[model samples]
Target: MTGESGTTRLPRQRDTTPTAQVRLLVAVGTDKHPFDRLVDWLAQWHAQAADPVRLTVQHGHTPAPGVPGGVPFLGHDALQQAMADADLVVCHGGPATILEARRHGHLPIVVPRDPARGEHVDDHQQLFARRLGAAGLVALCETREALHHALATGLADLSRYAVAADPHAHEARRAAVDRVGQIVEELVDRATRRPPRWRAWARPDRGAKETR
Candidate 1:
């Protein structure tokens, strides 16, 4: 947009989604919201909820200002702590966010933002979702319909603790314990492959010509 003095002035596109009812917390860490289009649908669903919907969007960086009920456009200091404390957490697929969600026992829904398509960088969220989803830990929503379903359902058992134990690691590969065995084998293999520094020094030097 050209200004009166011939300078360019950017136009802001406001999200027209009505926030009559919703009770969700949004956490996007420096990633464009690809699922942003679901805002209206989510808001509509929120309105149908028996309780009033209150959404708090916490942007980790300086992005465009979103619709009403949005916090500051800048990042916040207590983002993770807030997520840990929130009733329901909606966010991107990052290690920290996932870990926090698991630690707090809150069910988190990850939205992948694509930069190539002007949403986010590479599809890291896709990878995160794939790995976490396989673990039966998180709910990965790719399409808007899935996201709406997640929003309508909100989070499941949002009060649980993950102390890091092999609850499924017992026996058989198909068994829960089998997965634990896999993780243990991986750890042992990693440990045995790399000897201590003293072991490396104790090895005889084969580079020198062997004297008969």
Candidate 2:
């Protein structure tokens, strides 16, 4: 199929033949902040894995995980193809990536980047991910142990991470996306309306000396 960019896109048909090797795709998105924590977790999991697996990582700004299929970034068509071909999708807490994974028939395993760890500018991803997780959408893994467990479980039974690509499921996901958007907008509006703490201290006193 030809993509919107006029590039030949891979067919969305997944390989159903029985096979021992599992196909895994990991996307950290195009965020400038480095998500080294996720990369480290993946590297450690891959290093000690006993089962046959094919892992592909879109590392983005983070340093490569020294894995076989590590790529700095992927174009739109490439990403779609990767998602279609993957038996399991693991990605960051970005909503777009999560929706895309669902659209491609995968209940993605999500790991939100921590702002305290310098993975993002704020905690928006964490908040969004928590909302989705509570709704039973994406599988949210917040710590190294949780991520390791998710990887192990997914590798053992890839079907648990598969989602139906039907219209109803799509509509549900769309609504969830809209709700998250509204939440973000409200947060931004509140932040803009409130005065910063520094601004409050910058106010001139009634008896303060006037500038020349």
Residue-level lDDT tens digits of model 1 in 89-192:
66666655665554444557766554455555455555556566677677776666777677656533223212222212223213433453455455446534
RMSD of each: 17.9, 6.7
Q: Candidate 1 at residue 66, lDDT? A: 45
Query: Candidate 2, overall lDDT?
Result: 0.82
Candidate 1's C-alpha runs over 4 A off are 1-23, 32-50, 60-68, 72-77, 155-212
Highest lDDT: which candidate?
2
Candidate 1 global TM-score = 0.53
Worst 10 residues of 1 by lDDT: 161-170
Worst lDDT run of 10 residues, candidate 2, spans: 3-12
